[model samples]
Target: MSGSISRRDVIQAGAAVTITAAMVSGLAERAVAGPAIIPFSVSVPETALRDLMRRLAAVRWPEAETEKGWSQGVPLHQLQRLVDYWRTSYDWRRFESQINAFSQFRTEIDGLSIHFLHVRSRHENALPIVLTHGWPGSVIEFLKVIGPLTDPTAHDGRAEDAFHVIVPSMPGYGFSDKPSAPGWNIERIARAWTELVYRLGYVRWVAQGGDLGAFVTNTLALQKPSGLIAIHLNLALAIPSPLPTEGATLAEREAITAMARHGTDGSGYFQEQATRPQTIGYSLADSPVGLAAWIYEKFQAWTDNTGAPESALTRDEMLNDITLYWLTNTAASAARLYRENNGHGPNQGVVAFPVGISIFPREIVRVPRSWADKVYPNIIHWNELNKGGHFAAFEQPAIFTQELRDCFRGVRRT
Candidate 1:
């Protein structure tokens, strides 16, 4: 109690039960208003993997006019090696078990079959937390923290810090179905999640997200949906009032400089996602290697990893996330999120809801404290993490868990 809440606090909340038989039956017997999970198992079939391997092997990689850096496209040789591992050793079954280790369930909400992991707290009055993952990430992103956050019994804390967590696979990603009609933007997804928690009978809860998830949580906070409590995010992007003046603090000046440089260099993925998801969709859809390169590039850029992506995340973990995308065939749908949320309407400026900003050291865009304060007027908690990057939960669960635990302290829910 004297120091900032530790992982021990979660373990100290004491044993408590959530999702009682009544709650479970109520959920099961509830009206079939949402989409029902068609009884099925995920599989790619042997023939399919082999076919994809053949395609990757047979790709007509064009010899670059010059062997300059990766300015043109994924370097052919580098991609092939990663592809080879994917074809031979990348095991989806192992990762699937890793994913299913948490409580996995699928429910149809608002005509969409949504897949989510719901981990209940051990405390009688535990807070409900919804964690969202952005593109190029799956629920696998949070597998590292699930134990510490949900079952603090093993962490030397009690259940009060435990959370009834809901981590959903966004529509058009993972096991979720592809969008048949248009307009499944961040706002739409936020609305769907809003409907989801409300129907589950949760009166109040907090939202935590990163990458595209940060954007979605921002929308949820802005929309002020009923039962919404507060929002916490690991990634923050700020556009200063007057850009950066020479008189600005060093951090502010650095933020401005970073904005100028990353805005230019860090925008290719946005361009592709916004403009031609379908044009590039074929490569990712057909070639596992191509998908690995595309996703791997982000891991390299966003992670704390050095030159080699494997330095931050093992090849198995990295490929596991990629394999979900490949088997689910969600490259274009995931990409279209950019296209759908483009030219935002409600999500353009600062949100009014209470917000907690957690700053990780190696995020692609790090907002200066002075800059962040200006944007998040309701910022009650601000922290500079010791370690981590864009993929906070997966790369560094301890830091991510602590940041969220401290940030959401005293945050009221609906």
Candidate 2:
């Protein structure tokens, strides 16, 4: 097959494949003959680093909000402090080293060069899972869990619990190529992911995602692609068809209240990005502090923090993600995803495949089981986490890893 072969081409060819070292070597040879799975390493240019620092030094400050606390948005004092730390203390090389420590690669799927971290387990019969990250988040969210997931034995877990993990940067995010056309919506991303897994030669696999990643994973389950056995989601997008009446239960009332608050106060960025990504993109692309504050505001609001985002994520951790967007200059392109997929939600009725959901208390909307059951009928596993919030993997990696291990225990192929 040629490098331009579609995923359908590979699936139609239908060859049984395993992930042994020898098999990987054979696959590498085939990659050269067909579409090349090139080994990828990240090296940010010194010129870019200098430019980022220059922009940071020359940031134009905005006036403080009239409100006392976060009722308005990220405070000026807090943002200045964070910006100072990011400029002086945050180390981009350290973050780059952490990512490059893993086995990373880029391969063309659906006419786009997709960047992904492909870490295989040493354990026998390890389950394969594709992890998708959301907006204001990159593969950085999964860095903490990668070691625990891929090498369970090393992390005080049995080898049988190990997973062959694939964390991909969605199109227009991180190192992945930005889409120039207008057709790259959530469903298109789902198709790309289907092709990605099949192209890697996996016959059976599971998928896990949170936020926008959850949207894509749920779409995958809805599509019922060939190799996808099951799916686990941190953010349940299963909005019931014909919409249920509001205030049915206490939980439902709370969910409605929370969603209402977000829609009113927290959706400014959402609206702008969905309608005029280019307008905001200019600010994000040009100003480093502007980019930092834009993303940092979400970290503050979405996390399980009481007063500040620092209560949940460390300064360095937040900077690592923000720096990725700044260095890659992907702020506008990433924002365009919202425009391409405006008003997209879960399909009505029950998804046929096995679905697992983990609910965090402080998620944008704390979905009730009654509401979720209307859409996800085959919910084999459902857990309400006592702590954590929207960015579950980033805030609580240990709990997130365990959730996946337990949720997929029965779903894994023998």
Candidate 3:
């Protein structure tokens, strides 16, 4: 063979062979000595599909809120329309087929079966980048950007802009195994990412993330793990130590006011998830409509839509994510993450690695550049977008893709 063997080659060769528990044990032994990447696929059982439809059909709706609009959470009429479509017209298999078209697998990392999509570029010397998703979002968030990122030439860009992309479902969020005990916080997640990249045989790589993904990426930069060249974050959770208020600009003042408003009015879900995820989990796991309403509220609040979620994301796109949570029975496990890392603040670390930031207009807390500079000392690139919101990749994939291509051009390794 003239070409060097890549990790994908080993996975492709073993794709057909099924590994039993005993074989997995043997692989575990081998893993201690070297990398143990496995090939995997997604196949929801027929029974599960029937069950989801049945549940959607038999929903016991709550009465409409006295107040109009989203001030009181997702309106009853909006949710009903969404549910009707989900039960009558939405297609889960199509979403499954879309994701399954890409290469996916589960590998044991720190005793958990972590699921990820690994797509390699055909172009030689492509930069490897790992993308992580956040709460209420799954690997589906990056589905739209994967092709454009991995094969830029096919998507109206230069081959040099190509990237070998890896999108991982955060533990307990999607197909990834839920943590049995309690120690899987942001820091631990970052360490597992480091191991995951190394196991995939990348000597040099970069990372990008938003929401909870941003927290993980920020931690990775702070840890300064070996082989990580740089990182880019859409949600900058930068808080100055001891808090400074001596000199503030108009934007800074506005950002502070927004932060206060979020703390007061928009943190009910945060407080509940942080304190009592199990309680809400019961309602989430049993009632499909309940789960839809819970998540749908965030879609309305976070996106740049003009008071209507459909303005930003289609009903199909929203259902695709809601269905992932429903099928995986991950509603509770996912929420418990908030409890696991309660009181966790993103402003403590001092990162020395090069950092790039793309600030969307409607992000939860619009941290001013002055605030971000306090934590990320070596800022290489920073841009403020006119549109987009919390779910940048899911909501504005083209803009998100272009942002990454432009942001990483300076930091790309040879």
- Best lDDT goes to which candidate? 3
CA lDDT, candidate 3, residue 106: 79
State model 2's lDDT.
0.83
Q: Compared with the true structure, what per-residue lDDT tens digits does model 1 show for residues 1-414?
A: 111121222111223222322132112323323333332234345554566666656766656536655555556666767877876777767875676566665666777777777777665566777899997898789888878877766765565566778888899888776787888888889998887676555666789988888888988888998757788988774565557566888777666777676668877888888888888887787666678888988887788876667788998998888877876678888898888877753125877678898888888767877766666788978988767788999899888877777777666332
Local distance difference test, per candidate?
0.73, 0.83, 0.84
User: What is candidate 1's local distance difference test score?
Assistant: 0.73
- For every model shown, what is its TM-score relative to the native structure? 0.86, 0.91, 0.91
Query: Which scores higher on lDDT, 1 or 3?
Result: 3
lDDT of 3: 0.84
Q: Which ten residues in a row have the lowest lDDT in candidate 3?
A: 20-29
Question: Candidate 2: which stretches are off by over 4 Å?
Answer: 1-34, 241-247, 346-349
For candidate 1, the TM-score is 0.86
Distance from true position, residue 220, model 1, in Å?
A: 1.0
Candidate 2 lowest-lDDT run of ten: 1-10
Say which prediction, candidate 2 or candidate 3, comes out ahead on lDDT.
3
